[model samples]
Target: NLRVHLLEVEESVDRVFSDDSTKKAVNLLYMYPNGVNTVSSDIQGLTESSTNLGVVTTLENSIEYDSTARSS
Candidate 1:
C-alpha cells in the first residue's frame, strides 16, 4: 500500500515538471565531454589551493595526455 502511494506521488511530481521551462530551470549536474587534456586534483573537503593538491595529469601535446586519469 505504501509503495503504491509513493509511485502515485512520484508520477504526479513528474507531471508537474513535464514542461520545457521547468526542465530549463534545473541546472545540469554534469559537465560537457571534451577531448582536451587537463590536470586534475582532489580538492574535496580541503581548504588548500588546487595547485597544492599536485598535478594528477597534464597534456603532453595537442593530441596526447602526459598522464592518464588512473595514473597516480
Candidate 2:
C-alpha cells in the first residue's frame, strides 16, 4: 500500500516537473524513501543561487513501522 502510494506520488511529481513552464519557474529537489533516490533540477548555478535566495524545496517521507508491521 505504501509502495503503491509512493509510486503514485513520484509519478505526479515527475509530471509536474516535466512541464516547461514549471521547470523555468522554480528549483526543485526531490527525494524518495524506498528505492528511487534524489532528483534535482538542472538549473545552472543552483547551489550558489539557491543559497543566496534562501529558498529550498524538500520532499521527504518518514515512515516508521513497528515489529508487528503496523505504522508507528
Best by lDDT: 2
* Stretches of model 2 off by over 4 angstroms after superposition: 1-18, 27-72
Clashing pairs in 2: none
Which lDDT tens digits does candidate 2 get at residues 1-72? Answer: 122132334333432334664454332222222221223367543332211122234334322222211121
lDDT of 1 by residue, 1-72 (tens): 012132334333322433563344332211222232334457444333221111223233212212223222
lDDT accuracy of residue 51 in candidate 2:
14
Instruction: TM-score for candidate 1, please give it.
Output: 0.19
